[model samples]
Target: MTDLSNAIWRKSSLSGSGNDCVEVADDLPDAVAVRDSEDIQGPALTFESRQWSAFVSGVKRGEFDLA
Candidate 1:
């Protein structure tokens, strides 16, 4: 598992009132660490920077509808 002791996590701005969202850390130079906001001390999934960018772009494009 990656040592995320210094990773800075941020949740989605549109996250609901409840604690239901994914947290991400961009402090890593070549990867992004993601975890459930409801599980702070839980394990996180790491992805390559390029892959993360693509995922964000897809989100902005509404490829994954929230409604």
Candidate 2:
């Protein structure tokens, strides 16, 4: 398991004042962490830097958008 003790999490500013979005921690050297904003202490999902980058690119390209 990756040690995310020092990870710095942040969510998109466009999320508004609601706690319904996910938080991302990309400050880790080897991995990026993601977790529920409403559950900071809950388990997080980690991805390799390259993987995270690809995922982010896909999001920007609307690859996961619902019709």
Candidate 3:
């Protein structure tokens, strides 16, 4: 298991007032941690840095866009 004791999580600045966003912690050595803003103590998903970058790129390109 990854040691998240020192993780610093941050939410998107574009998010609205509703707690309907996710927070990310990229301070880990080799992985990025993501957790729901509504559930701080909930389960977190860990992804490789490269994988996260690719995912972000896809998001920027609207590859996951839905009508």
TM-score of 2: 0.93
* Backbone clashes in model 2, listed as residue pairs: none
Model 1 lDDT per residue over 1-67, tens place: 5678999999878896878898999889899999998999888999988999999999999999978
Structural similarity to truth (TM-score) of each candidate: 0.81, 0.93, 0.91
Of 1 and 2, which scores higher on TM-score? 2
Error of 3 at 15 (Å): 0.8
Q: Report the Cα lDDT for residue 50, model 1.
A: 98
Candidate 1 lDDT: 0.91
Which regions of candidate 1 fall more than 4 Å away from where they truly are? none
Candidate RMSDs in Å, in order, are 2.1, 0.8, 1.0
lDDT by residue (1-67, candidate 2, tens digit) is: 8998989999999999999999999999989999999999999999999999999899999999999
* Candidate 3 lDDT trough over 10 residues, lowest sum: 10-19
Which candidate leads in lDDT? Answer: 2
Q: Cα lDDT of all candidates, in order?
A: 0.91, 0.95, 0.94
Q: lDDT by residue for model 3 over 15-49, one digit each (tens)?
A: 97878999999999999999999999899999999
> How does candidate 3 fare on TM-score?
0.91
True-structure Cα RMSD, model 3 = 1.0
